[model samples]
Target: MPKKRRRISAFFKILTVLTVACGVLVAGGYYVIRSVQRVELTPPPPPSGCTLTAAGDTDELEVEQAANAATISGVAFGRDLPPHAVVVAFATVWQESKFRNIEFGDRDSVGLFQQRPSQEWGDPEQLMDPVYSSGEFYDGLVEIAGYEEMPVYEAAQAVQRSADGFAYDQHERRSRTMAAAFTGAEGPAVTCWYDTDEAGEADVEAAQAEMDRVFGTDGALPAAESRTGDPGWAMAAWAVANAERYGLTSVEYGGQRWSAAEGIDGWTEAPGEGGGAAAEDQVVLR
Candidate 1:
């Protein structure tokens, strides 16, 4: 009887140990599964956008808007116009079309500045072209006497002749920030990011042609080594702005590099001397 009782007790002890072991294993597995679930539930970062920072303020822009803004600023730079001119143009475009190259607006208005064909701004197709429209805006802006010294809204009004001329005032601060960034008054101020799968294959020829058209410098992009200062940074910012359109992977200038893969982080110090074989004065595009 004593032996039998001892055997029974040993069986109960074994059973308790086994039960406790199984419970511990089950608890550990549940914890691991919950941890994996938490990791999987984390959302990915949003893609496809650009930002310009200047004077301690950051402004966000849709990728298309950024490209158009860069074109406008590029035209000004090509003309050797002051940054104030870019500010005026930005204000006008913001009020007119929010920097979008749209086909429709109030009273047959169209394109970036909402220039109407009936009013002889241009044919619809020509007005729809960003480079052409930007050039047209700058052409009119420069003709306004004392426009450089005028308030942003006043200068924009002189060029746009909008019904509510004062409306351009609302965008003055934002315009200044954009002008400063795109004009390279602030180095590496423009940063853009997008998905690589969506960027498509880069078209070097197309990018070169567009740069020539906007900057009016034929064969200049290939000779980026000759460029420097604000002009160099401006060209670098232009490449960044149009990266999505041209499928550009990277742009480097002034010892800093901006890559599409790490674009949101802005410009980082280059690994080698002036972006490796590219001169410090150059805006190297890849």
Candidate 2:
């Protein structure tokens, strides 16, 4: 009888140990998931029957594409964020750094959102990642007390805390128009560029070539001024918004080994370096 009781006690002890071990494992798994989140930036699907062709012009298509991409990404996580939200974010990006994830900053800012690595947004790579930066922006938006309920620009300002807070107002309208087109739930770089110089001119050519190969088109996208709601500006803004990620500066893309010869308007105005203001205005989606 004594031996049997001892055996039973040992079994209970073993069970308790196993239970504790499982609890630890489960907690560890949850922590890992929260830390390394897998965020997909895919845009929304087109409404029943819509295509890029319906945009009538590239400018319109650009707006549409931005709207689509932003809206899709906003909505994808089951968040139901408005298209205007994305517009606000895109416009802010344009003004912030011409949408280029620059290595430069106020004292030493870097990445698309001009985030400071010291702030804990992430290490260098996280700041440079559009998806992560954008995700952080979106997360802040959702956390606001009445962000979605307020005017989009106001809501965005609440999250961005920009030096030029009031300026974000104008961008709200433009973002919606562009978001509509890119709504197919795409994660395709709503922005991109092939830096010929920083990337060794050939790399630029190769990137451009890849775009042409898959997209089947020339280097020149229809200018947004004439395209009207096409995804051009949105796409350009994305490229500008995330330019630093590709290792480019305004002067670099302006000419040099790359090809800013046209004196563009989407990311940077015809003006010199600090053109974040004009660039912000250019990609307004609405």
Candidate 3:
């Protein structure tokens, strides 16, 4: 009995030593690989609202900025759509208009989706509205194959018919990153905010009512945002900086062209989000 016990103890000691050695090798290898990789920390060029300041596209930046709440609702709650649907929608907008809906473009472009007036979409004034624009974009996208359920960029290109169709394919990882930054949902969902610029000073009655009709409850947005905004150019700049998220392009928003001028190392303070305390003032379109 003593000899048997001794043999078992010796075997156990050998196993422990091997396990420790293997663990060290794994840890060492992981550290070496990570140290050698020169990874890009950012999401690449057009560093969102922050980078737009460098391009003197402040007006455009505000247009692209997205509201966290509204975007979340759009992705998580919309019917016949899944959370990943939200990611795709987010990626599309992130790549398109950066979530900004506008009434002007380079030539004949207008609105958030940048549907060309008198060509691909409709008249100028109507196309300028975000809800109308997004709804239309959504309407067309649902028509694509597996779109309502497919990944975002794939569905987007099916609708956009863009030459750079693969572009949407690459935005998924980043889109999920942006969505996770706000509301953390399971795969296929994301969180977002509303565009204040497109409907600036415009009554949010319809939008709020739509929220109630669809969501069964308001998503608890700030009321002051719905009121007439006093924040100078921030409204405009927010739109431009975040345009790509929505899929805005030179030809999409009315042939509106984007160029790099110069950037202010520090952004001149513009009226930021949430200054009002009213309960009935905040709303998000689309």
Candidate 4:
């Protein structure tokens, strides 16, 4: 072949090879992109439990149990009782029913503390109501002389007069941790998460009514700014504890926000002017 012809043939040969290689590369890249797209990119679901941490120790409770624990603590707060009262209540309830408000127990012993109607604690319906039962527990607790200074189990036994008073002792540490969290002794110590899809319809009026019933206040819901200090945090904790039941999407207080969407991450710095400085004192609920 002529030298020019041979050079043109060589050029075509190289061009053909390059074109085939480019097609292969493009196909491989397209497949790689499609494969990545086919893989699920959704985030892992959040854990379905609640945790209360205090003094570097942590304890876990199911969502309902946490709510009941919060109610027990909130009642004491409303009564202006000391955190010790909450500790005693927690220990007693932990021994009695693991924080579950059930209908059956040892011969009509019902509710969180297992108060028996036959023993004149209250009618079964009233005893089954967490707020009433918690109040009754505190009522009995306060009647005892020097309950604040007593061992948790002894104090609980003073009110409950249970078959195994010593059982309360085993739960004292856990009770203390939970009490601290629920009482707001440790700031924002209670963290809870749930499936947002499964959350019930939130009723603000009902929540307010229940809050009033437990706290013994007929007043309106206090603004977060007005309720600064441990009391505010306690209220915030109560809201978090009851978030699932009330369908609370987010709770903002002390410039931090706990969002149901990102609940597993717990509280994060609120977004706004000064990183939620305006919300520092305000507990905005949504």
Judge candidate 4 against the unseen true structure and give its global Cα lDDT, from 0 to 1.
0.83
Number of clashing pairs, model 1? 0
Model 3 agreement with the true structure over 1-286: per-residue lDDT tens digits: 6999999999999999999999999999999899879675765233333322111112222313444224333423334344455566667766666566655665687755557766667677767655455556666766776775666667878776666877877767656554433222221121112332332343335434544433323544222222111111222222223233432221001111121221223222212333222212322221
Highest lDDT: give the candidate number: 1
Q: So what's the TM-score on candidate 1?
A: 0.84
Candidate 4 residue-wise lDDT, 36-140, digit = tens: 999998897766788878967988889999999988887876678888888899999999999999999998899999999988899999999999999999999
Which pairs of residues collide in candidate 1? none
Q: How would you encode candidate 2's per-residue C-alpha lDDT over 1-286 as one tens digit per residue?
A: 6999999999999999999999999999998897778665687432211123112323323322332243223322223345555566666665566555577788656766676667666777776655567666767777888665787667767877777777777765445544544432222213323322433322344434432322223654433332123333323433332233333333222211112322132222333444434333232111
TM-score of each: 0.84, 0.42, 0.42, 0.80
TM-score of 3: 0.42
State which candidate has the highest TM-score. Answer: 1
Error at 226, model 3, angstroms: 26
lDDT of each: 0.85, 0.47, 0.44, 0.83
Backbone N/Cα/C clashes per model: 0, 59, 66, 0
Model 1 lDDT-worst window of ten: 220-229
Show where candidate 2 strays beyond 4 Å.
Answer: 1-80, 185-286
